[model samples]
Target chain A: MALEANYGMVGDFYTQNFTTTHTGDGDTLILNLGPQHPSTHGVLRVVVELDGEYVKKAEPVLGYIHRMHEKMGEVKTYLQYLPNMGRVDYLHALGWNWAYVGAVEKLMGIEVPERAEFIRVITCELNRISSHLLWWGAYLLDLGAFTPILYAFADRERIMDILQMVTGSRLTYCYYRFGGVSADIGEKFISDLRAFLAQFKARIPMFHELVTGNMILRGRCVDIGVLPVEMCRRYGATGPVLRGSGVAYDVRRFEPYSVYDQLDFDVPVGKAGDAMDRYDVRVAEMVQSVRIIEQALDKLPEGPFLNPDLPDRFIPEPGEVYYSVEGARGKIGVYIVSDGSPKPYRLKLRSPSFSNLSLFAELSQGTLLGDAISIMGSLDLVIPEIDR
Target chain B: MATLGQTIKSLWSMVVGMKVTGIEFFKPKLTVHYPRKEVDNLGTYRGHCDLVAREDDPLTPKCIMCGICVDNCPSGCLSLTMHVVGEGKPRPAGGAGELMLAQEVILPGSIKKAPPTGKAERVLDSFRLNYNYCSLCGLCVQNCPVSSLAWSREAYLVGRSRQEFEFDLLARLRAKAASSQGVKAA
Candidate 1:
């Protein structure tokens, strides 16, 4: 150990955490890749064992940003816990919102209005686009490219602006209520979205020319940190991670939540389960999200957004239900157990980031030090969601 | 497993990447220098909870001191202290229908009465909101029976300490009421 980290910071939490695993004796060096490491994207401290420039083994240490969101659901009433969904995975908050609302709706057997379903689909897909846009930009930022994030934000800002029109908050949007959305999307919202899509569709090719097709990016990404389909299944990886591994198992298609089945959009799957494959899958998926939004916008039904004849209280009968929606990262599931109380007896959130990050140990083995960062970025780990 | 042709194609893609950035360099910058020019069109900005004045009375907010918002608040950021009028026990703010006087905090601006305004009329005591813990979830606004709670578009809500944020809503309401009345008189 090269002991010159004497800036009054003590305690070897890395060694303490890596007790079962190898903490490096001599030739192998132990490096903690941050609870706040810039490239880790969040408070994700990856204890990676290194042999010169190559990674020998990697272990992801979590729970630095735990907020006990599931426990909060147990104490708070059904309606009171609505805002917490926004904070869960803020990049794709609508997915969590739909998950929680859908779970509750299933328990109570509440029929969401047709217009509300369409609105939910349209808004959620747009949110998926925004989420992926952020990841794409942030992923490039992690890989040392600065310009792509700025360009990505230019488009992401537009999506957020359109979302902020109806959702009120730009980032943590608590728009969806129990039965329906908080507000209806006006004509201006639809027009703004249409214009954005038209411009964005043109810009995707530009993105390819700038970053995707670049030699430097391809050199770092292609055939690097390859995750096999079996490894993905064992790790419980869903969403783009699983899709990138040649599995077309999208929750929106396989489990048909919302109006996704009614709408037509191809799930992008990659041939090789590598970093480049994951990157390409996310990029292509954004286009699919755009298609979903366009279709939902055209088929926006005419009816009450919120259901009429509401119950006096949100007390669901003694029951349990599991509901899942396809998030930008993976499958966002909420399993609720109700003892006929106003609050949930037990609430559990199944975030995709958690499952996706679990395979880092297996994937990062024998890869270059820099390639680990690429693989982590491709995983699209939202640290808070994992900690939750 | 990149072939010679694929390698050459990827190398050429670097030139294409440069061209894309070169084209973008001439375009207008997307970001703005904040503090120099503020953002406009803040109509949808949900800042904090503002007590909506009653339809009849400008000074008095429609909050019945019922403390529904307090009970319903997920985070215990809200606390209300109201003085019982005559010979009643020190019950909670919203327990009775009597006109309640807000204790400790001075009723300046529009609500000038430290004592009871009248026997029939009800006035609120201090409705303390610790903005430090407030998530701005709008649960309080939705649960308010009188529809007296609403989100204020106050963009520049800055404070020095944690205590600075634990402000009384009644005082703010009275001040706003007085300022509006002053504008009308002027």
Candidate 2:
């Protein structure tokens, strides 16, 4: 009864601010979903107000794993700050690597070699597929499916092995330099990738048959937490979340950085704008990524991996530039302001997960608590990316 | 009835899902029993940076006491202390051969070089690497002018305390050099 009284006070406060009245006679229970819970992905706390099983209001509190990456950029030199990109989003690290490097390259008026450009495309796409695979596995796990994650990890491990040959580190890859990539992709890497592509093509259909076509999965996902395209626009949600809302707006297609302009790939768009649509969009995007990687590998040219003439201390002239790369979660934009110094004057990271997670409260309103987890899963929120 | 048909269709779909796992049941297990079993291939796994010994002279380090790696380390994990060897001082027995060997290995086409000051010769006194803070980004190895530093490939490197990770690379190099010379003498 005392707990009910406290919950009533908290619910009333949220009700006044969020303007969602509790229709039930009893006091609405407040649930703190995580700052440590596994389903939240990584240290993301969601305070949900519930009337019985239905969620009245949901608020996501972030910054548990915040290490002040932007502040570190200002203190460290341009070359020194490169490793920080990998830590920002460990899943889709290469995208952040590309974003920071692309921004610096733009400011310095440096032209990356054609071969290096192709390598960047190949590696970044491979990373995107891995990110999506992990999401696919984790999302299914959230919905009470355990077998799919093992299969997902089986594919992901192989991809990580291929990436490791060139990137050096598996998870947090600081592979890309300002002018070009750190290492050249050898014949072994290329041949291994080709083999993986051939194998993964067959595996994709099996995944669909096992997980996608399951009636229970379809029941849980379809028509649940429908995020209309209008909400995506207002909240600035990009990547699969926007595509799931029937808006085929991808940063790779829209912005077209690196060798993405030359590569031919379809932007997968969903029709229903729901959890299932998001799942479908990510799955389709992975296929497109594989396609892009295949093309990039075939056209992989011969040249120096790193620019020979580039100085050890890469100092960009006094200028500011903004660069965006399509990460696994969404658009990862890096804005760097340099005062003709080795260290940045100011650095800002525009993380897609932050914007995508913002609309969760709005989307979670009046939905069942179970569906709330499904909506969160579909968004693919990386807490470190959001916090950073 | 329509409900009976719908139930059958759902059951059939469930059966179809079971077929995937059924097929995978006979397939070789992906899990590796660690400690006893290891992954066949490392696939360019980078562990930590270690000072590489000279090819011709196993007693000498190719690191010319240039602080490029020390200066460029993002995490400040690398620290170098350069000791200026005085002209007349009997150069630390077996040090002359090591210095000559080190110079021959490092001198050709390298950007950073010790000054021919005649009064003092720069020798790397100590090279400390804090493995705990190291991101293993390979910036130090990449920036090294003489290619002195390399990835260790020591995957199973472990310690009970944090202090064990603070490696004195120069001391390791000297110990290696001493052992090799002792083998030659024997």
TM per candidate comes to 0.90, 0.90
lDDT string for model 2 (A150-206, tens) is 999999999998998998878999999978998999989999999999999999999
Candidate 1: the clashing residue pairs are: B65-B94, B99-B122, B102-B125
lDDT of 1 by residue, A203-260 (tens): 9999999999888888888998889999999989998999998999999899898788
Per-prediction DockQ scores? 0.34, 0.37
Residue A84 lDDT, candidate 1, scale 0-100: 92
Candidate 2 TM-score versus the reference? 0.90
Q: Which stretches of candidate 1 lie over 4 Å from their true place?
A: A1-25, B1-11, B83-121
Residue-level error in angstroms, candidate 2, position A149: 0.3
What interface RMSD does candidate 2 have? 7.2
Q: What share of the true interface contacts does candidate 2 keep?
A: 0.68
Question: What CAPRI grade goes to candidate 2?
Answer: acceptable
Angstrom error of the Cα, residue A379, model 1: value is 0.5
Per-model CA lDDT versus the true structure: 0.83, 0.85
* Native RMSD of candidate 2 (Å): 6.6
